[model samples]
Target: MKPTETDSTAVDWRGDSASSPDVTRRERLKETYEARVRTPALVAWADWRTRFGLLIIGGYVLMALVAVLGLWREPSTSQAPRLLGPFTDMSYPLGTTQSGVDLMALVIHSTPTILILITAGAVWATLIAVIIGTVAGYKGGSVDRGLMSFSDLVMAIPGLPLVIILAVTLNPENPVVLGVIINISYWAGLGRSLRSQVLTIRENNYVEASRTMGISTPRIILKDIIPNLMPYITVNFVFAARYVMFASVGLYFLGVLPYSTQNWGVTLNFAYSNGALFSWQAAHWLLAPMIAIMGLSLGLILLGQGLDRVFNPRVRTRMAGESKSTVADDDDDTVTEVF
Candidate 1:
C-alpha cells in the first residue's frame, strides 16, 4: 500500500523512539560500571587500616634496608653507642653479648638469615601446596583420597619435636639448610586448604565453559583456576613465614642448631646461656631479639589482615564499616556489593 509522506515520516519517528531508550540505558550502565571501579580503588587505598597496615610493613622494610646497609659498610672498629641502659656496654647501642660482640651488629647481620629462611620456606611450601592441591582437586576420587590421607599423615605428627630431631640430625651450620628443614614442616595443611578451594573453583561455570571449549585440563587449571586462588595463597604464605621462624627459633632455643652464624635465635641462645636472662643489666640483650621477632610477626599479621580485607568480602565489610562510606551499597544480597 502506498503511504502518504506524513505516514512515512511518522513510521520513521516511531523507529527512533524505540531505539533511544535502549541506547540511554546502555550509556547509563557503562557510566555506573566505570564509577564503581575507579571509586573503590581510591577508597580502598585511602582506608585507615589499609594505611596503618602499609605503614607497619613499610617500617619493617626500612629496618631491613638499614640492616643491609649496616652490613654493607666496611667493618667499623668503633661500635655503635649503647642507649638501652646496663644490659649493654656504652660502646654498643643494644649492648654486647658475653662474647663482647655488639648485639646491634649481630642483629643487623641476622636480618639476612631471617629473610632467607622466610623466602625459602615460603617458596617450597607454596610450590608444593599449589601442585598437590591443583592436581588432587582437579582429579578427584582415588587421587583426592590419597592426597588427603598424606596430608593427614603430615598433620598428625607434632611439628616442633620433629623439627628439633631433624635439625639436630642434620646439624645445620648454614641458614639455607635450616630453611629447607623448616619448610618441610609447613606445607601439608596449606595443601589441604588449597585443594579444597580448587575443588570448588573447578566447578565454577567459567571453568566448565572453558573445558567445553576443548581447553586442556592443565591449561585451564593454570589460566582459569589458579589466579583466582592467589589471594588465599598469599595469606597462607604470611602465616607460613611466621611458622618457619617459630620453628627455627624453637630449634635454636632447644640447643638443636647452636652455632651462631649471625642468626637471631642463635643470639638469643647465647644471651640465655650467659646469664642475660637473670641479670637485669643484660635485659636489653634479651629484649633486642624478642623485639625484632615481635615486630616482624606483627607486621606480617597486619599485612595479612589488610590483604584479607582486599580479598575476602566478609573482612572487607568490617573494614569498610570502620571507614564509613555513606553512598556505598552495604546490602549483602546484591552481587554488585564490593565488600
Candidate 2:
C-alpha cells in the first residue's frame, strides 16, 4: 500500500525501529571500537582459563594489600608462633622462622614489595620497547641500525652475569634501582619484537591511509599502530614482569643482594643458609616462600596466554566458535515472582 504524505514526510530516523535506519559513520566507528577494543576483554573474561588466572592474580593482589596495610594480624603476632610447625596450633599457622617470625605473615607481607618491583620493571621495559620499536620500525634506516646496534651490544653481553654485577654494586635497598636494572637487562629482546610488529602494522590499510592523508609519523603510530599492538604489549608485559620477578628473586636467594629486608627471596636465602632443610620438620619455612614464587610465576604465564585471545586476531578467530557474548538479550526471558 502507498504511504500517506504525512507518514512519508515524518521519517523514523531511530535505528532500532521496524524501518531500520541507515547506519551512520559514528555508529560504525563505535561498533568498530567495541569489536576491536571491548569485545576481546569480554571474550577473555568469559574464558575459564582467563577467569582462573585472574582469580589467582586477584588473590595475590588482595593479600598483598592486606599485608602492606598491616591488617594481616600484627607484626608482633608473627613472633609468637616462632619455631612451631604448621598445624601445630590455630594461632600459629604455617610455623615460624628461627628468628620467631610468623611464616604466613612474612610471606604475605613480603608479597606487595615484590609485586611492586616486578610491575614497575615491566612498565619501564614496555615503554622502552614501544618507543624504540615504533621509531625504528616506522622510520627505518640509520635510526634502525643505530638502535639495533645498541641492543645488540647489550644483548651480546652475558645477561645474568651483568645483572648480578649491577645488583651487587648498586644499592639493594632501592627497589627502583633494581627495577631499572631489570628493564635494562630485558628491554632489548622485546624492543626487537615490537619493531617487527610495527613493521607489519606499517602496511595496514588504515596506517597507509593516514600516511596518504598527510598525518605525521608520530601521531599515526600513536593513534593507530599502538592501539593495534595492545594485545602483544599486554602479553609481553606479563612475561616481562614474571621474568624480572624470577631474576630478582634468584639474585636475592643467592645472597647476591643484601638481606636486610623481609622478602620471600631473602627468607629463602636465610632458610637455606640456616639449615632449614636439615630436619624434615623445618620444611615449611623454605616451602612457604618457594610456593609463593611458583604461584606468582604460574599465574602470570597463564594470564599472558589467556590475554592472547583478546589481542591476537588469529587466536580470536580460532576461538570464535567457543566465545559467546556476555551481554544478555533485552527480551530473552521471563522472571518469576510470588506474592
Candidate 3:
C-alpha cells in the first residue's frame, strides 16, 4: 500500500492525475450539452424574418380559388346592375360598366385568365433561362458566343413597342396565344443572368469531381446544376409573373389587346371612358381594380422575400435567431474542437 501510494503521488507530480477524470468527463458532457441540445433548441424557437411568405402564399391561393369558382358560373348580364349581394340596387357590388356588366363578376371571371398568363409566362421564361444558361456557361467557345450573341440581339428590341407592333400585326383575339408572344420578349436577359451564375457554379470543386467521375453532360446539368439554381429560378418566376401582368395590362390599356375581354386593364379603360375617375359616386369603380393589382403585386414581393430568407443559408441562420446574443452564441459554437 505504501508503494502504491508513492506511485500514485509520482503520477500526480508528473501532471497525469486520474482524480480529475470525473471533472474532464463533466466538462465533456457540458460541451456535448451545449452542442447537441442548447443550440438547436434556441434556433428552433427563434424568430423567422421570412414570416411574410405564409401570408403571400395564402393570398395567391385565395385568388386561385376564387378564380376557379368563377370558372363554373355563366357570365352574368348587367342589364340592371345589382350591388354585390342579393339586395343591392342596379349599381354593382363592385360597381357597373357603362354597358351594365357587373364589375365583381368581371373581376372574378378575369382572374383565371390573368393567372394563366402570369403562370405560363413565368414558367416558360424560367425554362428558357435555365436551359440557355446551362448550355452557354458549361460549354464555352463557339456555342457560348453564338447563344450570347443571339440573346443580345433579342434584348436590343424594345419590349413595349415590339409587343404593340406584334399585337397590331397579328391581331390575336385569344388570350393564351397573346400570352405566348409576350414571353418571347422576356427570356433573353433572364437567360444571360442565369448563364453568368452557371459559369460561376460550374468552376467549383464539386462540379469538377463530378466531371472527373465521368458524369454525363446532361446528368451534370439536370441533376447537379439545375437543383442548385432553384432559389434564383423561383425568385425570377415571381418577378416574371409581375412583369407579364404589367405588360398585359399596358397592352390592354393601349387597345392593342382584344377590347371585348373582361380583363382588369379593359375594365380600367372602360372606367376611364365612363368618367368613373371624375365622378365621385363612381370612384369605387376605378379604385377597386387598382387595389387588386397592388395587392397581388405586394403578395408576390413578400413571397419572394420569404423564399430569399429560406434559400440563403446565411439568411436562414439570421432568421433562426431571435436575439443578438443567441445568434452570437450559435456562431461561436458552430465549430467542434476534437481532442
Candidate 4:
C-alpha cells in the first residue's frame, strides 16, 4: 500500500513543526526587544528637543566627571597671568580671574557641586511631596485636612527669607546640607499640587477597583496609584531641582553660604566684588559662571518639556502607533523585496 498525496504532504508539515518552536522563540525575543528597547529609543529620539536637551546635559555630566576625577588641570592652581582676557591664550580659553584662577577650570569644577546640590534637594523635596500628597489624597477626610492645613502654614512663611535665615544660622558648607536648607520651604506647594492630582487619580476606576479588592492601603497606593502619578512627579522633580539651583546660587551670591572657591555663585560674587561689572577686561570673569547657570537651567527646562511627550499617555499612544506602523511598513517592504 502506497501513501496518498495528502498523507505525504502531512508528513512534510509534521517535519516543519520541529522548527516551529525555534521560530516562535525567536519571534518572542524579537517582540520583547522591540517593545522594551527599540520602541522606547524611537519614542525618545522622535523629539528633537529631547535630543538637544540630552546633549547639553550629557556634556555637563562629562565635564563634571572630568573635573571631579582631576582629568583636567586643577581649577585652583594659578597657572596663567591675572586678568588675561578670554581667547588671549589657548591654555586659558576662558581667561583668568583677578587672582589668576583659570576661569574655565572654575566653571568645570563648579558643575559637580551645583549638580549634587540640585539632585539632593530635588530628591528630598519630591520624596516628601509624594509621601504627603499620596497619603493625604488617598486617605482623605481628617488626614487630608490636617496635611493641607500644615502645608498651608508652611506656604505662608516667606520661602527666600526663611532660606536666608537658615543659611545664616546653620552656615552649612556641604552642598547636601545647603540643598536641604534651601529647599526647606519649597516642598509644601508642590505637595499641595500633587495632592490635587492624587485626588483625581484615586477616583479612577482602576484605583477604585483596587480599593474594592482586599488590597492593603499601602500596597494599593504604592503599586496602583503611584505609577499613575509618575509623569507628574518626574516633571515636578525637575522643577524642584531648578528651584534649588536658583536658591543655592542666590544664597552663595549673597555671601550667606560659607565661601568656596569652587562655587559658581561664589565665583560670581568674587567677580562682582572685584569690580568685574565695571571693568571691560574682567567681563569674562562675570559671564563665565552666569553662562554656566543659565545653560544648566535651559537644559532642565527643555528636558522637562520633552519628557511630557514621552510620559504622556495620549502622546505616547499616538507616537507608539506611528512607530508600529512604520515598522510594519518596513517589514512589508522587506518581504516584497524577498518575493
**Leading candidate by lDDT:** 4
For model 3, how does the per-residue alpha-carbon lDDT over 26-62 read when each residue is reduced to its tens digit? 9999878754466444433343423554565476566
Top-down lDDT ranking: 4, 2, 1, 3
Q: Residues 36-145, candidate 1: write the lDDT tens digits.
A: 55444444465566667678667766656877776433113434443245433545666665555677666666776787777788778888888888888988999999
lDDT tens readout by residue for model 4, 58-132: 889998999889987887776789999999998999999998999889889889888989999999899998999
How far residue 222's Cα lies from its native spot in candidate 1, in Å, is 2.6
Give the lDDT of residue 226 in candidate 2: 91
* Candidate 1 lowest-lDDT run of ten: 71-80
Model 2, span 78-100: residue lDDT tens: 54745788878767677888878
Using TM-score, give the best candidate's number. 4
lDDT to native, each model? 0.73, 0.80, 0.72, 0.87
Determine the backbone clash count of candidate 2.
1
Q: Whole-model lDDT for model 3 versus the true structure?
A: 0.72
Candidate order by decreasing TM-score = 4, 2, 3, 1
The worst-scoring run of ten residues by lDDT in candidate 4 lies at 308-317
